[model samples]
Each structure stands twice: as C-alpha cells, then as structure tokens.
Target: MEKFKITDLDLYYGTFKALIKVNLTIEANQITAFIGPSGCGKSTLLKSLNRMNDLIEGCRIDGNVLLDGEDIYGNIDVNLLRKRVGMVFQKPNPFPMSIYDNVAYGPRTHGIHSKIKLDEIVETSLRNAAIWDELKDRLKKSALGISGGQQQRLCIARALAVQPEVLLMDEPTSALDPISTSKIEDLISELKERYTIIIVTHNMQQAVRISDKTAFFLLGQVIEYDTTENIFSNPRQKETEDYITGRFG
Candidate 1:
C-alpha cells in the first residue's frame, strides 16, 4: 500500500528552485531513505510531504502530494494533516518539562484532556519507541536531563503519541554517538512494522542498514531509486556508484 504519492513535484524557496520534477511513491509500514549530499533537495521533499514548507515565507510548490490517495495540498486542514504525519527533527527537541508531559503533549494538543487517557497514551507511546523500560521510573523528571540518545527516543515517543500514520525523520541520529546511533537504528527497525518511515540520511551505511528502499538524489533531482540491496550493490547510475563508494558526495 502506498502511503504517499508525489508526482511532477517542484519546490522553490524565494527565487531559487530547490526541487524539480520529483516523482515517487512511499509505501506503508516500511522504511524509505533519501540519501545525498548537503542541499540536494532531500530535506526539501521531506518537508513538502506534510506541508512544513508552508511555514517558510516565499516558499512555493507545484505538483501533487497525495496522502492515502487524497491531495494534502488541497482543502484539507493543515493541523489534521500534521497529526496524521508526525515529524522528528535532526536534533532531540523535547519540551523542558517532565518526560510524561513530553509524551503527552501531542494528545493534549488534539483535545485529549483526561488525565487517565493521557497516562495510557504516554505509556503506550514510550513503549512503542522502546524507551519505556528506561524511563518509566523517571517519568516525572525533566526531559532535558536525559542523555542525547534517550532524548531522541523521547522525541520519537512524543511523535507516536499523536497516533501518526507516517513518521518523517531528518537525520535523526546525526548527533548521537555510535552506541546511541545503534539504539535508534534498532528502534527504527521495530517501528516499520506499524508506521511508514521516511528518513533523510547522509550516512550511507545507516541507509543500507535500516531502509527497505533507497532514493539517491543529486543536484535537486532523484538520480535513482530502488531496493536497498540493489541501490548499494548494483546501482544503475554511475553517479550513485561514485557517491556510495566515497569517490565524492
């Protein structure tokens, strides 16, 4: 099942064209990776999925981005669209509150006000993100006090609390150490069974390790997209081979 279908997509920031004629289909309950060097429109296309680009002044897009067969750019409510498509940023951005409150924030935003209901959502989301066992005793402690890796998992739990169908992650493990990065990689593996995940990563190994499909982008265009094994071992494009082999990014 396709969770998102993007066709003839073009995106611009002010006068600069950031993406051009992009087309792709993202499958449900699987991990898809976008890999490229800096400023190659990988993040640009990711932001367009849920209209995060709408917040930028003079940002414009031309094309169709469909979520579950409905055009997200149409008359849909932006808030509701966001609820269905949650995002975790490059950095861990937990609220400066208790761990429990951090996980409960999204449900609260959607009018889930009961304390009992919030508690259940908090616990379930934390467990789903594979962080409940580590943080259960510290639920009342400040989220800012945790380790960087734990904080990232907390952010994931927070996103999960909204009951999102898709998770958009932009270099989620970039700032973490090797051990922390490994934990996140494991969590992503577990997460794909329930939620469709789209990630932008500069780490080729990480993409190979976690993603089922890989899309290689260059100069604002997707040069190749295919299964992760095929992309890593036998890409059709010379540019892809060069990039993956460390000849150049």
Candidate 2:
C-alpha cells in the first residue's frame, strides 16, 4: 500500500540548495505530517511530490520521487498526474465565481461537461469536504463572500472534485480561527479513509492531533520519521526530543 517512495532527493533553486538527501515512503490512505520551523524545506518537499516546483524558474531536482511505482519526473502527462494528486494551500483561495462553479472547475477541465455529472460531482465533493450542508443553499453565491473557514472547506471541496487519490495540504488551517481549525482537523481525519494525505504543518499539536505518521524536518533534511506516537513520546533523536519538548525547533 505504498503511495509514494522518495530516495536521495536533492532540490535546488538556481544556486541555492533547498533540500538535502531525503528518503521516505508514504503509505496509502494515511495522514503523514511534515513538521518543522520556518524555511526548513518541509513545504518544498511537499510541493515536490506533485511536481509543483516545476513552475519555479530555476528549480531542479536530482532524485527519485515515485508515485505508485512510477517515476513522477519520468515521461508522463503532467496534467494527468496533477489531476490524480491535488493540493490545497495555506490560505483559502476560492475562485471569484460561485461556490458550485469552484467545485465543478476540476471536473470541467477534465472534460466532464454535462450539467448532471458536474452537479453530482460538486455535491459529492462538498459532502466529502464536510461543507455540503453548510453551502448547499449558497451554491450560486460568490465564493469570496463566505467566511475564511468556510472558504477553506470550499477549497478542500474543490480539491476533492477532481477525484484525486492523494491530497497535499500545505498548512491548511493556519489562516483560520481555533473553531475553524478544529473543524478542518476533523474533516482531514475523516478524509484519510479515502485519500492518502501529506500535510506540511508548523503546528506540532495539529500534527499530533491528526497524522498517523510524523516526519521532523530541519536544515533542509528529515531528522526523524516514525509513528506520530513514537515521534512525540519516545523520539530516538535528541533533536527530535528537543523539538517536541519545546527546547528548540
């Protein structure tokens, strides 16, 4: 049930090396968290999984990032790869259009043009994001009009609309209130039953709350990776113990 296998990954932007030799295997239908301080390259590694770094001007990767045994950097359709692996950013970035349109956008791009099909996909995606009941009545309204938390959930719904197998979340709840953060945390926990989730989070408590596995990143390297319980309770590395114990990040 391995979803991703990364080995000897080294990423760079122009002259600066951003990530060092990294190796990890992400399992299927589980939540894996990348936690570290700012500029530790956790987010860079997350973006690398789906090839989001390709958009950067001088970004280069010298390593293997395999998705389901196939090299993602190999001869493959990038669009199709992206369709199967969706991402949600730190802030909720809903389209200026209606909520329904936002959810239907992915299916539409992938050639699902029928209204009936789009409607079903929209509703189902919203339900999967745990926001259908909240937004069903407001599908025609501008997505920008919703609260920040609702907007984030809508973004999640949009990611789900593509029927992706893996969902990459980059600090998904950082911009929300405590109540909103809790709601999204619950939603993410529920999502692991269907999608393999890799989240880059600065919040250690959030990782402990939802992730099945935790990978601690520092100085552009993964210091330790293990079950969340082990990483938090019985860490093998002094650095990990220092980090989890609030000694230093």
Candidate 3:
C-alpha cells in the first residue's frame, strides 16, 4: 500500500528552486532512503513530507502531497498532520528535563492527563525506540546527562509517543559513534515492521544497509528510485551508478 503519494512536487525559496517537479510513492511500513550529495534537495524533499518547510521564511511549494490519499496541503490542520507524521532531525534534541518528562511531553501537550496512562505511553514509546531497557531505572534523570546516542533514542521515543503513522528522519546517526550508529541502524530495521520510515542520508553504505527502497537525487531531481538490491547492484541510470561507485557525486 502507498502511504504517501507526491506528484510533481516543486519547491522554492524566494526565487530559487530547491526541488524540481518530482513524483514518487512511498510504500507503507517500509524504509525508504533518499540518497544524494549535499544540497541536492534530499533534505528539502524529506521536509516536504511533513510540511516542515512551512516554518521556513519565503518558502513555497507547488504540487500535491497526499497522505493516505488525502491532500495534506489543502485546507488541512498542520498540527494534526504533524501528529500523524513525526520527524527526527539530524541532531538529538531532547528537552532539558527528566527522561520521563521528555518522553511524556508530546502526549501531555495533546491532553493525555492521567498519570497512569502517561506512564504506560512513556514506557511503550521508550521500548519501541529501543531505549527502555537501558534507562528504565533512570527515567527521572535529566536527558542531557545521557550519551549522544541515548539522547537520540530518547528523541525517537518522544516522537513515537505521539503515535505517528509515518516517521521522517534526516541523517539521524550522522553525529554518533560507530557503535551507536549500528544500534540506530538496527532500530531502523525493527521500526519498518510497524511504521513507514523516510530518511535522508548522505551515507551510501547506511542507505544500502537499511533501506528497502532507495531514491537517488541529483541537482534537485529524482534520478532513480527502486528496490535497494537493484539500486546498489544494477541501477538503470548511469548517474546513479556513477554516484554509487564513487566515480562522482
């Protein structure tokens, strides 16, 4: 099933075109990676999925972005759409509060008042993010005290607590150590069973390692998109082949 359908998406910041007309269908409950060099519109396209670009000054979009067959950009509540599609940034940005509070923040803001219910949601989200086992006893500790990787997991837990159907990540492990990066990669594999994931990553190896489908972008356009195996092994586009083979990017 297609969870998202983007058709002829063209984005602009003032007069500069950041993305050209692009069409793609993101499969439900799968990991889709947007791989490209810096400034190729990979991040811009990812932000469009959840309308994150709306926050940027002078940004404009021309096209249709359908979520579950509904046009999200047409008279829809931005807040509600965001709840259905959560986002994690390139950096781990946990709140300067207790770990429990950090995880519970979203549900609380959305009017989950009962302490018992909030507790359960927190635990479930943390477990889903693969951080509960390590931080169960330290739930009251400040999130800032945790390691960078743990902080990122906590951020993931916070996003999950909102019960989003689609999760968007932008270079989620870029700043982490090797071991931490591996853990997050493993978590991405586990997450695809339940939530649709769209990630923008510069790391070709990571994209090849964790994604079910890979999309290659160049000069603000989608050059190719296909199964991970096909993309890495036998891409039909010479540009994709060159990018993947370290010939040029």
> Model 2, 120-237: lDDT tens per residue?
9999999999999999999999999999999999999999999999999999999999999999999999999999999999898999999999999898899999999999989999
lDDT scores of the candidates, listed in order: 0.95, 0.95, 0.94
Query: What digit string (tens of lDDT, one per residue) describes model 1 on residues 1-249?
Result: 999999999999999999989999999999999998899999999999999999999999999999999999999999999999999999999999999999998898899999999999999999999999999999999999999999999999999999999999999999999999999999999999999999999999999999999999998899999999999999999999999999974
How many steric overlaps are in each model, in order? 0, 0, 0
Candidate 3, poorest ten consecutive residues by summed lDDT: 240-249
lDDT of 3 at 56: 96
Structural similarity to truth (TM-score) of each candidate: 0.99, 0.99, 0.98
Global Cα RMSD, each model: 0.8, 0.8, 0.8
User: By TM-score, how accurate is candidate 3?
Assistant: 0.98
**Lowest-sum lDDT 10-residue window in model 2:** 240-249
Which one wins by lDDT: 1 or 3?
Answer: 1
Candidate 2: where is the Cα deviation over 4 Å? none
